[model samples]
Target chain A: MKIERREFLKLGAAVAVGLGGGLTLDVLTKTKPAAAETRTDVAGTRVSSKALHAKRWAMVVDASKFKTEEDFRRVKEACVKAHNIPDFGPDSKHQIKWIWEEPFERTFYGVDDPYLPEAIKKENFPVMCNHCENPPCVRVCPTQATFKRPDGIVGMDYHRCIGCRFCMAACPFGARSFNFVDPRPYIKDINPDFPTRTKGVVEKCNFCMERLDQGLMPVCVEASNGALVFGDLDDPTSDVRKILDTHYAIRRKPELGTGPSVFYLVGGGGAGA
Target chain B: MLEKALSGSRRYWAWIVFLLLLILVGFLAYMRQFEIGLGVTGMSRDVSWGLYIAQFTFLVGVAASAVMVAIPYYLHDYKRFKDIVIYGEFLAVSCVVMCILFIFVDLGQPMRIMNVILHPTPHSMMFWDMCVLFGYLLLNFIIGWTSLGAERKGFPHPHWVKVLAYIAIPWAVSIHTVTAFLYSGLPARSFWLSAIMAARFLASAFAAGPALLVIFLLILRKVSSFKVGKEALQALAKIVAYAMIANVFFFLLEVFTAFYSRIPEDMAAFQYLFWGLDGKHSLVPFMWSAAVLALLGIALLVIPRTRKNEVILPFAMAAVYLAAWIDKGVNLILAGFVPNPFGQVIQYAPTATEIMIVIGVYAIGLLILTVLYKVVLGVREERA
Candidate 1:
């Protein structure tokens, strides 16, 4: 398509500004590597190589192991407490759920059959940000505030977000949440470690990058008692890769071709059918 | 030049005063929204967009409608539209202003709206939309002002102005197409994801814009001595008829594909819009009314006798205007959200504050129209 001279000039200006903003963001987010330190566990054993960079982060939740509502609630509480996500209880319209529960039918909505077994149909699955390889939210973000990191984690820069809600609309999984009102008042006990979001900006699960940086597993994974697997998918030796190779796990809305990193192992044959 | 608009009758001043009052009330409501956030309005996480974005979508078509008059007068040398073309451009100018205001008010971080400019992502359709809208606004402003100035001076319009007019013809189509692209490209909303969205948008715009123009021109004819001849109105009615037919046909194409394919995701939105999915029928009556009105409007305009009749022509144009409005402004955006990603219904209805802001925005548009028309009429009357 041939653009008029004036239109071209306007576009040029926009590109120039975009480049400038990109440089600024890079400078602001650049962090020191924490002096290449090694950490020891409580029993004085090395748990992980602290300086090792994850090539691709992924999560796999075994649905059968999450048998009780209390099991799901513990995971939710850990994520919420760690992230300082506000509680807007029972008001679904205003509620901000980073990771929440859904029925098996709703979780695997389009793929699931109507006449599935009652036990399978009644199962509740814990859902969160899929951290898609090709995230629609990142693609549609006007400000680049929501982006897919090199580690296959979809990240949000709340400070840079313009609050257009475009990311919220673009997320097909409904993973993103907009702070419709000031979230501070509703937050009963703010976690000092995590920063709370202001009203208007969109937010979602960030795969707990902060916890990972400190050589710790994500709070949800820790709370799940071996039910949830978290590891570098790029590493063939990682726990997630091992599980994917052995088990039949499905990602939500895989037909959309987003290539979601989060996988679910429902175990009982007809859960996906 | 602006002094001419200032020198108007008592009725003109009264109208301006009324618009100012509405604007004041809207401003107050906006202040409240600014403090609290979009939660002050009816918009939820499910329905992220509501009245503000809807009006923005509708008025973009209104702004682009000026092309209907411009193309006939400038491109085809249709002299019948000569006197009224300025009004069309002026209407477009006002509508564009209103469109900008709607977007501004809809923004969560209104202050950071400049980020769209500061950190533009060309991949984002919204960024492209912003560029084209601002460009279109500038094009209309320059074309309308220069042409009106040339007319006031009693000189032949310059060669450059004609070139710009030609450029504007396609640019007008691009503005609406780009606006449609803003919705269509999103894979998240099945209701908006379609190849024909831009074509459908242009068809609806071609009908709605011209229809609104005709109604405004008829009103001008009664209130003032600004005469848009019978032949001109008839020709416009014909354009409206054909465009409305295409628009309705495009909509039906969507319906046919959704139902025939039996794709649950594709059919879900339409079901929510027409019959209400899972007991959510908020937009059901409105969608049905718009469909009926569109049919009636098409029938009225398609018949030559009714189309040519002055009294009936206004009714026909009104029907076309309201039908397109309800279709685009009310049904389109809401349907995109219902059965949201999780396949659940979350209803949305605008609060009083939201409604008042909409009214205020319309009043602002009318106020601009009144002032611009006053200037155009004064210049024409002096020449006469």
Candidate 2:
């Protein structure tokens, strides 16, 4: 029952924290809900005259419609130009890409179809961040710098990101990219409406959160002709859900249990070879 | 205590100056990196982490090894470890300092590091890792300094010091376990998503930590009045032998699981490490070297004749240390990111700038260790 100097100090600290620290924490937490609403507004919801609202956002990519390399290039260019994603050239290891093309085998892994249709086999699939319903990236992010919004957009606060790249490691889709260098100089054309990321912060396709706030569709969807469908997944009547319902769509690495919001329509292109 | 480090032999001063010079070079490289970006390093979108995180991972093991010394002396009340436990604690202090620095340098925004604490996300293993690492540093620093000070004044350590020592034993295991969780919990990297990751990390840390302690104690015995008896060194060697065997056994278990099950994703990283996976064999040589060295270390340590030889023992310990460093540090972090999620292989070699920064962090850690050890040597010499 003897209290030594160390125990005495511990008791004092406990008392101080119980009284002063609790009061400080109370003041801090009291203002949290108001601040969180603003955070949600800044990150997800903005009350515009024509702003789009949805419980969960999702995408359906008609892989068959992307017949030529130009189809992929168009959407990529639209995203890059709109986001001010720097062009580090083809050979640069430090390239930042928002949307890019991957081979069919690489995109939807575990596919061992030997006699795929020539059209489907030759075509490159467009891949980007799935904005997962249960994002591992968000779970691993130390600072809540990346989080999931109510609308199902996996959002990133670049300023808050400490650039640990935990998100990059957590993302199974290879979606996230870190700015290895100052990205401003590499940007061919700076998008004034959108802010460019500094070196060190992790970034990926944000489903055009900024554009969505303005009642505009994602630039990729707009530039994708009929290949890309973006809408509310929570609403079954939405275009993305409708396409998902009608087609035998598959997500990237579904077995991993990330519940990818993005789906690709396969076997929808003519008959198999 | 602080003044003891200020006065040292010509050779000690020379070593200090050399570390300072390396620190200077590293500082300059870091400033350049700060102005430019991590682009100065070889990391790309494909391979995000490299040497900095690797060194951090390795040092965490070295830091956690203090528990090996603590358990025998403090928990088991073994008198043989009484003189050396302080050395183990001081070594832990320096390593934890280096671990924090490595994380600091690896940060995209070092200035914004407080954000992790400010917005606490208990769900993030990185957050837990930060908490445990810092807590371990504080624990070791207080325990080592307080106990050493009491000894310097010719009195037993206060009652609470013993309590803190017991707490530190579990704290040591937690630091490395939390670090393993940082990788193991990730869904993307098939290489790291293993249930045995924490067990493997603890096994390696136990081996590598004590092996390092043996080397440091041997060096201390040679150059100073500090001399541990042969029995203590032998006891440490036994710990290293058993732990090294456990580490290798755990790794073989992983190999068996990967190959026998024939999970392509699980096998891809092992293939990338041991043999060239799709003509990308950058890490194959390192992995093989670690395997050979680990086996050699085990052979040297397992045999009583070689383990007892003070001259040969240091070499065996060095081999153990390097193997653990390469396996846990280099291979684990780098190869885990390979064949990325897209099944693409992008080669990642640390840039010269990255290496310099790494050396700088090591120099800082070594400098701290030298100063702390100097103080220990000074206090012991007075007692003698």
Candidate 3:
């Protein structure tokens, strides 16, 4: 077959687009740290003056004082309800989890005895999607259904999901959940409140994109009695930064190379803080 | 008077009736799924993929095995395979059709699948997978069926058939390679995150796919009085034996490196798969059984005495099919997810509805194969 001018142009465009995508990724990787150095002023922008670290969303959970199951319920209920996660028998359909309390042994990496009632501090700390810096979910999703935002929070395109569930399979944290069945019936209120996911699709925590659009902290943060601290991680002056500076904080599965955005702080028997 | 030879054929009719009943049951089950949703199946959030995906993985290999015939006879010009070559192509046609159907049933909404074609995602491997698989199916059907149609008309085969033959060989290998990449390219799922997965997928596909084709075609040879000679059977069996050796070698390499590397994350999945972690349902039994079957099958094929024995040859082919399916179908996907990343053991089993769909998909495949076989056999026999 003879080559047409349009086909040639189309071929050129394909190559250009391919290279453009590669170039954009390269620029992003290179420009990230240097951009962090140029830290902009939040006072002049739409960001809250009080919420100094507009981008940093971090939490310091003091697991030492938690004695009973009620402590776990209070924090978990607030976190789950805030995100409007559709509850399964106990979990969720696609398991729409924002936070939870894993047993000390499950949470820690390596220790001779992870659960020492007195030494280990048997309180509950909430766990949510890490929203990794280099998320494997985004890498494996064949449909770009799952992606990491420029701001570091990961998001999923419900409509684009082919129900292949590759993202769920790829996540190290068991973070993504696939909608094996239709979710619409279980959601009676229609949650025009939150975006509804379809059956045979995958859904997970989006780090609460709807609230972010309205310029508010995540519902879980607001529900907390100073439990979760949400702010700009890039800015050092944010409340999350102050907390991180004051106490030692840890992330789940730090060795896997998925740089977690959510941090945890275990301290003096504090009430879910 | 001529009917005397064919009257005791309740077996042929019995098989058809049985498969039709299964297809009906499958259709009703599918209707229930469409009305209620995929919830009718056993799959949930944690165990996202179930039996349907497993079957798809297995059948894709079946479709790709047509390559063995194409490679040796077409590329290398082996005369013994001349008769079995057509059988391979027809098997491919039915398998690919079944493979596509299985995926369609697996989807949440079959209609929305068009979006993948309409609004393409080049970055997505699924996009390439769709294009390659669909193209391979059409290419095989047209090239195989059209030549058969020409033969039935008492005409010399078209020159275009030769060009199509050459294209089909590489095209066959690509279908499985691309399928393997669909899993291997994923940066996560340490179990499948290996570099040599694509090669392993191809090797396994060749071994199992042709062995299956031989068994299926041999049945046709016996029942229909089709002259599929011993020479064709022997050549195909030998090809399968070589492919099996490669598959086993790859498995050993994976085991050796995974155990030796001292990486817990990588080794953990394998340990769960073969040895069973701390007494939770050891897949080791299934895997070892598959290994045993494969080795026995290889021995039965490669040795001169075993190859001469008709009983051993067919038995070996069936054994080869079982080994390959267990390795790729049941174990491959489960191994990746077990002892889930949090180090918690998760249990998964196909629900009744899930099993029904699987049965339906197989019945559908057999139905297609039967029709294709009848048509091709009629044409070929008339010519003969």
Candidate 4:
């Protein structure tokens, strides 16, 4: 079992080289440090100095202000363009829309109203992920593919999603969409900035997290012409809270206790109306 | 035991060949689905899950049904089930294998399936389901093989085998209960959201599982030297009858609750399944047929003369099997997704490719069942 001096030196050299290689590998593989404390980039991506920060990001939709189909279309177009969302033609089966419109009756089905305003009923309300305070999708995801950030946005990591579609079933708003087919083929013009998903993974609105990192407002909010307001629910001075304070706001399926961040300013008496 | 399965009669080999062909076809269909995407199936964004999930749900119950035989034999020391208990365990092994396969095939990213384990999220029922289903498969395979081997060698099985059997009884219940929770825990799906969902799942499972066992037993009687006694068949039929009645009772209770409360959310899915929601009636025919067959099977099983009649029992069991398949296998999962949370009625039907793929999975299950059953019969025949 005794080792010669030459053999001992050779083994020592091998051990030293192995240790040095391992240390170098560890440093190389380490994730890049955050740009700053104020604005945290999600995936080691660059964040602009003037990036938006929120304790809990929220969106306030004044459905009453959405008067025309063009208003809805423009906002939807902006999101589609920014996100590189696929168009699965008109068929609803394989369709992958991050943000879309539903009629007033469907959007506010939980808010019972036998005698609602005809104008409100006629309008198509834009719906996306509610990003619930107690998000079921996050709770149900086996791989944490879909998770809620500190800012209260329910973010999806498409690469990690095993595409079991449990999150799709868990969402009450029908916000999530599965990539039934390869989404790359359907994208008319792919946005290189935002990542496009492959087939078999579930996807939904990320509330423009990357844009927030770049100090840009959500494309839908910027496009809506005052119909959609994006702000921090936690901040009292935020637009969402100010609007909540001034006018009564209703959330979809509030009874379910998901505590949705998205609020609808439907004018009359909110839920009672 | 392995040698017993390898060598069989012309009919057995022919059956094996048929299953292999089906499996080959199914693998090809699955490849296409893998290449193109889940779009090859009839599933949509609205009906996020289709045939694969439904079959997974159904087979979980079937796999759990092995407990029906295991319990009476192991717990109650029911001597009648002693001769047939191995058959039940083997059946479970096959069904559990199919159950795992169904879940694997249903995944959008099947390759990343290890992620379920890689990053274990205990909060997710799926992770727990993965644990329990695999655990159940292992328990059954070990118990069935060891017990059969011990019998062949003319010795009592080890005490650890009995301890495992005890663990399996509750473990069996957990596999189906967790599966029921996978649906019932979801707040969005009102149809599946009920206090009695687990109970209903157990009831249907008890009915479906034993009825299937009876059919397998009858088939064994015909094709091989394996003979499950008339008393055992009758006892199993009684269990099936009681469970089938309970299943129907649970359905009626749900109907009553939904209709009485008149909560649109609660009633919407039921309306979609039984009648048509927004003029969409794709599931109505299937649902009605399930109802009628369920009632018919219950009546036949309850009647003493019909239950005692060997010729009639198989037909009655078949009715029960088909009815449960329609209700739990096809409609339950489909109806849960109907009205799509937006209250829109979107119809879904499986494609030919999807059906072929399903057939392939069943072929795998049957192949396992056939080989396992062959070994059991071989051991018994050799003893005789």
Q: In lDDT terms, how accurate is model 4?
A: 0.87
Tell me the native contact fraction for each prediction.
0.68, 0.84, 0.50, 0.82
Q: Which stretches of candidate 2 lie over 4 Å from their true place?
A: A1-46, A269-273
Encode model 2's per-residue lDDT on B1-384: one tens digit a residue. Answer: 778889989989999999999999999999999999898998888889899998999899988668999999998999999989988999999999999999999988888999998899999999899889989999999999999899999999999999999999999999989999999998899899999999999999999989999998988888877887899999999999999999999999999999999988899999999997889999999999999999999999999899889899999999999999999889999999878877888889988999999999999989999999999899878887
* lDDT per residue as tens, model 4, B1-384: 888998889999999999999999999999999999898999898998899999999988887568999999999999999988888888889998999999888999999999999889999999999999999999999999999999998889889999999999999989889999998988888988898999899999999999999999999999898878999999999999999999999989999999999998899989988888998999999999999999999999999999999999999999998999999999999999977778788889999989999999999999999999899888877877
lDDT of 2 by residue, A222-252 (tens): 9998788899999989988767666688889
The list of candidate 3 runs beyond 4 A from truth reads A1-68, A91-96, A108-124, A184-192, A241-249, A266-273, B1-14, B282-284
Enumerate the chain B TM-scores of all models: 0.98, 0.99, 0.94, 0.99
Q: Encode model 3's per-residue lDDT on B199-303: one tens digit a residue.
A: 888888998889898888778868895767787788888888888889889988888888999777678778887777857765788888998898888888888
Worst 10 residues of 2 chain B by lDDT: B338-347
The candidate, 1 or 2, that scores higher on DockQ is: 2
The C-alpha local distance difference test score for the whole of candidate 1 amounts to: 0.84
What TM value does model 1 have? 0.92
**Candidate 1 structure quality by residue, lDDT tens digits, B57-143:** 999988856899999999899999988888888889898899899988888788888888888899988888888888788887788
State every prediction's TM-score relative to the real structure.
0.92, 0.92, 0.84, 0.93
Candidate 3 achieves a global lDDT of 0.70
Of 1 and 4, which scores higher on DockQ? Answer: 4
- What is the C-alpha lDDT profile of model 1 across A135-197, one tens digit per residue? 988988888989887788899988788788888778889888889899998887888667888
Report DockQ per prediction, comma-separated. Answer: 0.57, 0.62, 0.32, 0.67
- Candidate 4 lDDT at B130 equals 92
- Winning candidate number (DockQ): 4
lDDT of 1 at B74: 95
